[model samples]
Target: MKVEDITSSEQAIALEDQHGAHNYHPLPAVLKKGKGVFVWDVENKKYYDFLSAYSAVNQGHCHPRIVNAMTKQAETITLTSRAFHNNVLGVFEKYATEYFDFDKLLPMNTGAEAVETAIKICRKWAYEKKGIAETEAQIVVFENNFHGRTTTIISFSNDEGARKNFGPYTPGFIKIAYDDTHSLEEILKENKNIAGVLIEPIQGEAGVYTPADSFIPKVKELCNAHNVLFMADEIQTGIARTGALLAVCGKCDCQGHCERQATYSRPDLLILGKALSGGAYPVSAVLADNEVMNVIQPGQHGSTFGGNPVAAAVAMEALEVVRDEKLAQNARKLGDLFRSELNRYIVDSSVVNLVRGRGLLNAIVINDAEDSSTAWDICVALKENGLLAKPTHGNIIRFAPPLVINEEQILDCVKIITDTLKQFEK
Candidate 1:
């Protein structure tokens, strides 16, 4: 059907089902507008945004400052392709490099592209700098990790659904148990051709499985000791969604340039996306110091719209919003309140097993089998009760609202969630 013909929610879903790729099974909500932490459907029914586009809309939807930047830049210029330098790319590079404490930044348009770029950089750095044989460098990745759907990125994924039939898959990846430092260290020690260790600070797609607090620091130590590059895929967990500026900054108060902070488990290469533009544009970046970032010279890698004018402008303002509004602090404060309130309710809960996560990146495991529809049913109930959330895995529901959400809204969401789960009591 034509765009004008798609008037109702059912029509929209039907159009997507009929015309678009059958890739995703989205919840049945036809959202028309969003502001702060609330979204309204086509029927004008308002609901709290609990998922935040998988933490993409961390700064809230249609963030005014980011939107203004995007509009102002788009009027003048948009994509200028890497053949000719744009006016804003350098400024963005300098601003972001310094903001994240990286000496250089390689901008990309999506989380997958950034991950691919990092893999290329890591492999090249190993061959050129670490003296490894070409194409023999194996990057260590974790089980249950979700970097992106790209073939190379998925090469390391353990999810059968994401990996099966997507091959003959890319090789040269070493998989280890998630959050297991011993196995990671053993792999690094046993394999001299290992180039980098890629990981998510919090495995968001694997039901927000936050490793032990000691897990990341130990991985960092082992990587350093074994002289392996540590690459953090913070696309889902970074940019203040996890309370701190980055999930690696565990409980850190320093808002800007977290690498210097002691608690920060710094990675040799940092991959970020989703909220980098405050969900205004596709802006993903890979950051590293000169020693690592400089490995990729001209013509080695780039994108036509990687560091476009609008992306640069939008991303700069997005970072500014995170700092100016102290979204990190807000996330931290509200995260504590959310967990405490949820934990209080969980004491009497049979539907919910437990709550686990740091800051706002959290999930509750349903007391049901992995193949069960309990979590999905609960999400539908949540939508019906004036909130919107979705299950990540079979029986795990992730609850990550925008960082801009206030305490009162959080409490209200908590009530809706608890009330919904209460209905599913076995």
Candidate 2:
């Protein structure tokens, strides 16, 4: 079909359905433009963006600062293949390292790339620093984890759809139950060659499963005691999507009261993406202290698009936007309001089982079977009601708006959600 023939939303959806891979089953609305907390469908219908592109657009869509940096850098120079040092890469490295409080930063193009980089760094650290034998080091991962789609990443995934027929999978990954410190401790005790524990601060793809209050600190303690690297995949929960700059900072008592405390559960290796470029570009990084990062020498691991000038410029601005705008503080306040409103609605409705999350990264569990399409149906209603959201698993819908959303917009969204849920109640 010609481009001009695609005038209606149905025609656009049909084009994608026929031409594109069926990897995603998105909401029927065809978004054509977005700004701040709202997106416009092809038919010029406006809707509150509750999903925020899976927490990638935490700074809001088409953020001016980030886009300007990207555009200027693109005009000057974009890619240099990392063979030669680009001007923006070092600047970005310094900014990112300081921002994340890490000694070094390895830039990559996507969250999955950062995760893979962390895995390699951890394993190399085990072999070179800890003197573990080659090919014997194991990393512990939690069940229901959504690290990425790489062959090595899926090797540790427990989801049948992600793993089935994709293996013969990569080995040396120990799977344990999530949010269970005792299980991790037991695994650590049994495996002397354990390299690291990679975990998401909040499991976004697994339906925003925030662990117990002490889970992060306890995991840090165990990793320290066992001499294992504590790798945090903050790609989804980082960049102020949670209350704090990072979900690891959730331990900080600075809930609109004081500045962030210096002491916190510091991950040995930090994987960041998504909001790193504020959804303007694909930018991800793995941060580590000298000791852990030094394990990988030259030519150990690298990506061509990694640390490109455009990505570097965009990421630097994106992080600045996060701090300057105090997106974390906004997420915290709005998140509290969102949960409170949803909790009130839940008291009278049977369609929603519960609402749980930290900051703007939250999800509502449906009072239906795990594999049911009730959440999808509700999302259809949400789209009709001028709000857009998607289900993570089968019966759980994650409502993560951009951190740039205001109080009035949040209240408006809450009403949309409540009204939509009430319709499902009958």
Candidate 3:
């Protein structure tokens, strides 16, 4: 029962199954270590990491630069709280705001916190600036959206599993179908009390659902016309996961230049997390321009560990890695190879109905019932074949590897996936 006795993957898996709170049903293999695109199980079996910690490790696992920065900061100072200033915080804020082209950055520790912060900022702006009456500001959200797991977040979620027994929910949220601009526009036009429209440029959780190319620009226009704040929850899609710096960049095919102008769909508020620290540390932030971010005077919304020194140091290095390494460019190249290779098999295989996504953030739709266990079965088979992936919905499995992945590695992964699918067919 001791750690030494657990020399095999099964033993480690057994220990977790017995002691841990069954929050997640992970694949049977027990990951002992990871570097770049590969992970080693407890038994020393190697497998390609395809999830990238839900797109949080865009710069790869345990990136030396980010880890070194974190270690250096840890040796000096890790946490000072927001009561006093930390050297790294100001630098991180300045660097991040400039990197994201935002006027201000409110640092937090988790993705959900950033989302909550964005929500609070929008509400404050609605009341103070937009003249919305107290307790009457509504935010328009999309169906099948996965913002976070906070009570307030789940309150607006349409997923039964996420919302069941989680209510009576938080109010003032209107839900509409996703990818339907007309539905959003109709709601916005009729609901004069709407304060903001919070959306994911590409829905990550319900599956990597990329909206139409014009969706973001049109939504921004609608929000501007109605004086409603346009907020983007780029927690999973940001940080170059979608081949762009942000999914809203409207340059799915381009690497450096965006097809749409920067001002075309500039969000009033932006929520970021996951890869902000390159999976080295948990660092998330809410970004806003002066007018929107200035609503919160002080003591309104804060977290004790929100802007810790370790997070600040780690985030700065992580973002630097993204820019210096050109991870976005790498993701764009590898992602095209991944989807193009998969499409060849998908055209002939009944097991896979479709493969859709941008950059490294992609998913495969299994040709099975929504409640079927086909995707899970495929994932288990994939694990046996030296690749690691997980099913998001019942019939959808997302395959988002680290952005640091190379062409040879991607082609190898494609072979693993195609070979595995062929076995399933037999």
Candidate 4:
């Protein structure tokens, strides 16, 4: 059925429930349109988009530049499998590689695919370059790390719901405590067969969990010392969502796109997605230098629609929008304001326990049991109050508005959030 034919939200939701796979338990807000920092529901009720499509719309929803690029390219050519080169792929590769200061980029459709690509490269590098024995390469990962839902990616994940029953899992991953430098170092030191350390610079799905200020850099330093690949899954925390071009870039003030500053952690392999196409397309990439990325040959690793022209055009425009808009600087300034405001509210309220995050990526921990519906309840209330947000876990509501959000909108949204929380305060 067509959207215009479906008059009620219930009917739309009912159709989805009946036919769609039960993979997600999303809030019942059926979004029909989006622009900038706001989205309109099926009922035409506008709300501040606090989630930014899980940071995929960092350049803002339906950004004109990105959309125009996609549409214009769509009218021309969209996909030409890696079997033959498209007109735009090489241009995008050069643009992206130079922009991120990497020697090469392996394009993919989603964050999970990019992650899998990084894993393949890392493992191959381990055998061919590092000279590790065949089938002995182990990649160190952290607890509560959310890379993707793929079988191999989830093999290292500790989340019971995502990991349960799905495996007779893949092996060669060693899990360690997150944010613990000593544990990471010890694991790398003790385990010589380790090929890489896959980590989220900021654990977004694990409740917007930002690590110690020094954690990322130290992890990179250790990975270097141990001759292990430091693969940063920036697919969520990247693209100016975390107050920097890359979350591993720390809080550097450069908005013209990262140039390997002193503050940058400099991962050996960088996985990026989500915001790469500004929610305009499914575009993700794994970037590395010659030594590491060259591990895989032509036939070994390529995707049918990975570097297609449409993705290439959309991604370039999306990245250009990020730089031209000074998204990193804006995210930094607004994030500080958001946390400061939310922090003040948390101190006085019984419903909220704390707000922790960097830049636009922040989350509030509800003062309720992990199993309680309090956070979800708060989000529903937020929806009614002209804002939209969702809980990451049972008690954690992540608030990651688009980097384009103005100061007034941030404050307005914060008011709506705080006012709603008061209803549940003890």
Alpha-carbon lDDT, every model: 0.91, 0.90, 0.89, 0.91
lDDT of 4 at 3: 67
Q: Compute the lDDT for candidate 1.
A: 0.91
What's the CA error at residue 355 for candidate 4, in Å? 0.7
Q: How high is each candidate's TM-score?
A: 0.98, 0.97, 0.97, 0.99
lDDT score, candidate 4? 0.91
Q: How close to the true structure is residue 158 of candidate 1, measured as C-alpha lDDT? A: 80
Tens-digit per-residue lDDT, 90-196, candidate 2: 99999888777789999999999999999999999999989899999999999999999999999999888888999889999998899999999988898899999
Native-to-model Cα distance after best TM-score fit, residue 67 in candidate 3, in Å: 0.5
Which pairs clash inside model 2? none
Candidate 1 lDDT, 83-162, residue by residue in tens? 99989999999999888888999999999999999999999999999999998999889888899999887777888888
Worst 10 residues of 2 by lDDT: 255-264
In TM-score terms, candidate 4 sits at 0.99
For lDDT, the strongest prediction is 4
Worst 10 residues of 1 by lDDT: 250-259
Candidate 3 lDDT, 1-426, residue by residue in tens = 566687887777777788898878888888878999999987889999999999999999889999999999999988888899988899989999988888999999999999999999999999999999999999999999999989999999988887899788999999988888898888887888999999999898898988888888899899999999999998999988878888888765555334255633778998999999999989999999999899888799999999999999999999889888888888888888899999988887978989999889999998899899888998999999999999987899999999999999999999999889887773
Off by over 4 Å in 2: 1-5, 255-263
Looking at model 2, residue 36 earns an lDDT score of 93
